[model samples]
Target chain A: MRATFMYGAGDVRVEEVPDPTIVQPTDALVRITLACVCGSDLHPYHSMPTGEEGTPMGHEFIGLVEELGSEVTGLKVGDLVISPFAFSDNTCEFCREGFHTACKHGGWYGAGGVGGAQAEMIRVPQASGTLVPIPGDVDEKLLPSLLALSDVYLTGYHAAHMGNVGPGKTVTVIGDGAVGLSAVLASKQMGADKIILMGRHVDRTGLGRRFGATDVVAERGDEGIAKVLELTGGEGSHVVLEAVGHMPAYEQAYGVVRPGGVISRVGVPQYEDAPVGFGSLFGKNVTLNGGPAPVRAYIEAAIPQVLSGEIDPGRVFDSETTLDDVAEAYRLMDSRTALKVLVRP
Target chain B: MRATFMYGAGDVRVEEVPDPTIVQPTDALVRITLACVCGSDLHPYHSMPTGEEGTPMGHEFIGLVEELGSEVTGLKVGDLVISPFAFSDNTCEFCREGFHTACKHGGWYGAGGVGGAQAEMIRVPQASGTLVPIPGDVDEKLLPSLLALSDVYLTGYHAAHMGNVGPGKTVTVIGDGAVGLSAVLASKQMGADKIILMGRHVDRTGLGRRFGATDVVAERGDEGIAKVLELTGGEGSHVVLEAVGHMPAYEQAYGVVRPGGVISRVGVPQYEDAPVGFGSLFGKNVTLNGGPAPVRAYIEAAIPQVLSGEIDPGRVFDSETTLDDVAEAYRLMDSRTALKVLVRP
Candidate 1:
């Protein structure tokens, strides 16, 4: 089967790899229908290898269950489902608390030598908990948005929830990519009174505004925070969503939140030693909460909105290509030419 | 008026200073009935000018309102009150949200050019917010413990509250000073089932046990955390109270809290930067909250316990001396000769 593999940094290729089969009794073999590049993928794409071996890329996907292991329950062959970026048993104490990402037995696909979503068929561990049957028949046209619920949209929503974004909250979103844009939408859904989207592009900024960004700051670094502070009456936003993982964006998120506010970083930190400055964070009495989003937790509610056409997150897919063009898709994403690239398998 | 002043690292003296008078419309002159040495006072007492102007000391006190400014309301002369360490207006939005320490016009006492509380008469700012009226007269002998609620006890309670210490939760307290001991008491009040007091003193540890610490670990640093983790089946405590303000204690707080748990630090970090390695905090999704305690918020509920003898934090004051013996008191506390020293002016 043709699958995406990283030969090296900036060297993602669609190569002939063996098709995945259900090896564990609790696993399900899923045939990928749609997959999109995640912001987290860019980490390995630019930096040194994250794993000991060459890795498969991509974790966000919507797919059909091609086969199910004997131990798998609540799922059947030929069913369309959404798999959370991280696999969990969904029955653990942590998962019971809606923190599936922190499940005792939870693990990540496309990471730790496991094959990822950018494949013809992938074996999903703990399938009963990993796969959420799609609400209804999902058209290929809406696959990108549904695929988004598997990771980015839910992550944005999780960031909003963690930051306590709600009515009358003034939120500053630091990052204009799909996750950041999704946060704008989620903040609106959660009734944030004002949202300042910080970005460097006009097209994405416009999309951010359309998705409920009450204001946009095109400046970078301190200037962006200055604009956010200005918009929030100099006290800074009540909640700041850090959707871009880096020192600068993280620092900006810290700078723009009001005292006793929150800075929720959904952007996966690329470095092992991410310095979440406690001194600055402590002085402001701010709360920092972030990790892999509990995508399944939000999917049950988010999928309905996407299915009802209430939200059109698919508009984020500015480029679309076939599995054969997966290499160029990776290049386009690496070169920042695409907001999001959808790949059809 | 007589005031306790630190002449140098080891030199304390009772000396006459300018009598405090109401400087702001919101200020009141309080005749301090009781004042206690705080752990924070040790910081400057150990580092102040060797032979320069001696630093005035003390920030925690219970006093009788001897004079009121023209604008003061809700408090009157002759009323006994508990003065929170922080002077805040208490009517701001932040105060309404129960974070009076972050009130818009809030100011801390004793460290930033503010005169010390170890004086016969001290000026109280934002009197309406900073001073809580004592419900009824209590025995003068109990003043020491009641005075503790003005700072340390309230601070420990705040730490426990911020860390979400509650029923069935396991809590690890990182410091066994007055505040840490007080936290053991507070955690019990909050319904925490398993409380571990990590201290090195037999006397303080005994007091901690009486105050509801179910376990005690005398080990320090990494060894202390290892003991805590071992006791908790390697998952670490559900809530960690960092009551010692130092790099090592802060690191221990981070090292011992379980994933998705909380670490509350009420100990004032004297360093310009709170040296925290966020790699662990971020990965575990720990909620860190601490600062100056908002005692005004808790005094109303805590006074009854103090008066009824249900909780005697005053027992922490192992020694009492005349203001003339200020030097001896400083030395005793600095050398850990006393858990707390109460001085009579």
Candidate 2:
């Protein structure tokens, strides 16, 4: 089977890798139907530490189950399904509490030298808990949007949910990446009255507007904060969705959130320390939430919307490539030439 | 008038100070009827910066309105009122959002050379917004508890509220100081079924139990976390109230909170930076909320509970002294000889 692997910084290649097989009674073998280059994949693609062994690379995918182990239940061979970025036994305490990312028996794809989603075949542990079955045949046009439920859309939904974004509230989404754009759509779906997208890219911000961003701030840092505050009548937004996980993005979030509001962050943070002491967020009574999205928890609820043609998160996939062009897909996404690149197996 | 002033580290004195007068039309002078040494005061009392000038030191007080400027409405001379730790116009955007501590026109007591609450009289700015009038006060025994509503009780309530404590949830409160003890009580008021108090001091933890701690974990750091996890059947508490503001307290909070739970911190943090990146909380989807209590927002709702004789947070005040003995009060609290010291002028 062919899989994408990063040889080193700024290096990506699609090469033959051993096919995955069900190794545990709870495992299921999935043949990838669709996969994508995620923004987070760029983290290591940009500067993964040198000398690390090349490994299968991808966490989001929609596939058809090819085989299942004895213990797997409610799912059978040839079923169409979506897998969250991480696999979890949904019955764990954390999973039951809606924090499937922290499931006791769960782990991230490709972690610990395991095969990942960017492969033709991958083993999904805890299949019954990790796989969300799609009933009947799914439309080819709906593939990208449904595939988004695996990570980006669910991640964006987590941000809005954590931020408590709801009717009559003003939401400011920072970052113009696919996740940020998805957050704009999710905020709109959550009934936010005013959705503000903070991004400098004209093309991305234009999509943001189409995704229901009522306003756009094309500045970064202090300037962006000023514009958001100005747009919010000098009070700042009631909920600030932090889709970019870096020091600057977090600083802007803290700067633009109204006192007593929440800043929901879903970006895989790049920095180690955040100044969350008395001088920063404490005095304002703001709530800081968001981490890895409990995508499995949201996938079920989000699917109906996509199926009903209520939302088209697939718009984020501006470019499409095949398994052989996985390397090019990464390059295009890294350079921002494409918002998101859909990869077909 | 006499005021408790910190002359240097470990040096506290009650000295003569000029009487307060209304400097603005919005100001109101209050004669301090009750004041208590706060856990936060120990921050400077233990090791104040060298070469810093002496400053009046107290933030919690219930008093009689001694005088009111012409523009001070809804309050009059001789009225009993409780002043929150910070003074705010209570009409600013932040204040309107229930974050009075961040009010544009507000500032903390004893800050910037201003008068503090541990004095015979205090000149409250934005009196209309800063003072909460008590309809009628007769019993002197209830003074300590009512005074607590100004800061400690309100702060505790804020932590519980921010943590989203409710019926059937398990709550773990860090710190056994007055505020922490108050949090145990607050958690109970919020209907937490199990309240665990994490503190090392027998005397303090004893008070915590009286307040509403169903269990006590007499350890700190990792050991404390382990104990809490064990208590909750390895699932961790649903709500972890951070009543201590130091790094270890926060670490314990993050360690003991269940995935998807909240860590509400009310401690005036001693550290500048917290690791809020993926390694810290994002993976667990834990929510970090609470800062300065926004006491003004909570005082109204909490006061009714205290006034109704349903909760006696004043039990935290184990010792009593007069204004002349203010220095002694600090000594006892600093040595942990007193959980809390009530002072009268």
Candidate 3:
């Protein structure tokens, strides 16, 4: 099997790895049909240390069930399915509480001996609870959108959900990355009255506008905060979806959130300390939420939205490649040449 | 009229000051009948820098509307009222959203030239929006509980409300002070299935139990975390009300919160920075919320509860003093000799 691996900083490679077999009665083997590079993967790509044994790279993927686990009752061989980035039993206390990413029996795809999804074939543990099966053969064109449900779209949805985005609320999405754009779309679907996209790239912001951003702020820092404040009549947005996990993004989130509004972050935070004292959240009485998307908890409701043509979250994938060119997929996103890249095996 | 002011850390004095009169068209001169030293007041009592002109000392108070400004239509002379700690127009976007502390025209009482509530006569700005009036003041026995709605009890309610404490949810209240005890009472009123008090003081935790703490842990740091984990089947509490605003209290909040639970802080945060990165909140997917309690928004509902004997939130006031002994009130609360002190003028 060919899997994507990170050798060191800015280096990703498609290398031969042994094929995975169902080791547990609850596990199933999946043949990857579609996988993609994630913004999070760049976290490691930009700074991961060199190693003899490279790190497995991707977490998002859609596939055909190649072999079913004997204990898996909800899925069978040949079914097209989507696997949320984190695999879970989906029956634990956290899972039942709609926090599947925190499920006691769950773990991320690239952790706990689980292979990355950006491979030719991967073994999925807790298959019944982790994989969402599509009834028949999925339309070839629908693969990208279905692949999004596995992580990106749902990750975006989690931001809106966590931020309490709802009817008549104004939302500011800070980032034009795939996840940020998906959040714009998700906010629109959630019936947000207005969405402001804070990103510099006209091209990406254009896509953001199509994703339902009512406005876009090209400036950064105090200027960006000024523009967002202006747009919201100086009160700021009801919710700020912080999709760029940098400190500046977090700062902007607090800078422009209306007092008592929410700042929901899906971007993996690159820093440990943030101001939550009197000068920041405490002074304004704002709420801060968001973490790894409980996409597993959200995927079911999102499936029909994608199927019904209500949202085309796959529009985030601006570039495409084959498994052999997975390294370039990483490069395209890393170099800002692509919003997201779709890789087919 | 005499007023209480802090000359420096631990230096509280009651000095003759000009009697307050209606200064703004929306102001009312409150003949403060009851005022109390709050847990928040201790923040300044401990380390407030010395100054030629000392800072005003109290915020919570109940009084008779001695005089009303021309524009103050909702309150009149001789009317009894309880003023929330912060004065606000209470009709702005934030106030309408039930976050009165962030009202567009709102400001804290001890700020913006408003005299401290611990005085003979204090002028309240935005009177209609800031003071909740009781129809007739008759019972002396219920005065303390009514005084509580001004801040402490409602502040506690804000913690529970912000943390989303509801039926069948387990809650951990992290403080043994007036506000934390109020949180226990508030959590009980909100129907939390189990309430844990993480405080060492026997007398305080005893009050917390009366207020509805099902379990009390005297340990701090890791031992407290272990005990709370054991109490909740190792999943921690669904809601953690952080009534102690120090870093250790904040740390315990994250340490004992269930995955995806809420950590609501109503305490005046003493520090400026905390961890929100992968190591603390992000990995657990926990939600952090709360600021100064929007007591203005909550007082209306609480009035009925106190009036009907549904709750005795006033039990938090363990000490009482007179206007001449205002300095002693601060001393008692500062020295931990009182959970809260009621000062009458």
- Judged by TM-score, which candidate is best? 3
Where is model 2 chain A poorest over a 10-residue stretch in terms of lDDT? A47-56
| Number of the candidate with higher TM-score, 1 or 2 | 2
lDDT of 3 by residue, B10-127 (tens): 8899899889877789998989889999888888888889888888878989988888888888777888898899999988889999988888888977777888988888989999
Ordered by DockQ, highest first, the candidates read: 3, 2, 1
Evaluated with lDDT, which candidate comes out highest? Answer: 3
Question: Candidate 3 DockQ category?
Answer: high
After superposing the true interface residues, what Cα RMSD does each candidate give?
A: 3.8, 1.2, 0.7
Clashes in model 1: which pairs?
A: none
Give residue A140's error in model 3 in angstroms: 1.0
Best of the two (1, 3) by DockQ: 3
Cα lDDT of model 3 by residue, A1-345, tens digit? 899888899878889889999899999999999999999999998998888878888999998899987799888788888999999999999999999989888888877798998889999999999999876555677779999999898999999999999998999999999899999999999999999999998899999999999999999999999999999999988999999999999999999999999999999999999999988998888899899998988888877777777888998999999999999998899899999999998
Q: State the C-alpha lDDT per candidate.
A: 0.83, 0.90, 0.91
Rank order (by lDDT, best first): 3, 2, 1
Residues A28-58 of candidate 2: C-alpha lDDT, one tens digit per residue = 9999999998999999998877656786789
How does the DockQ of candidate 2 come out? 0.79
Q: Model 3, which residues run further than 4 Å from truth?
A: none
Give candidates' CA RMSD values in order.
Answer: 2.2, 1.9, 1.0
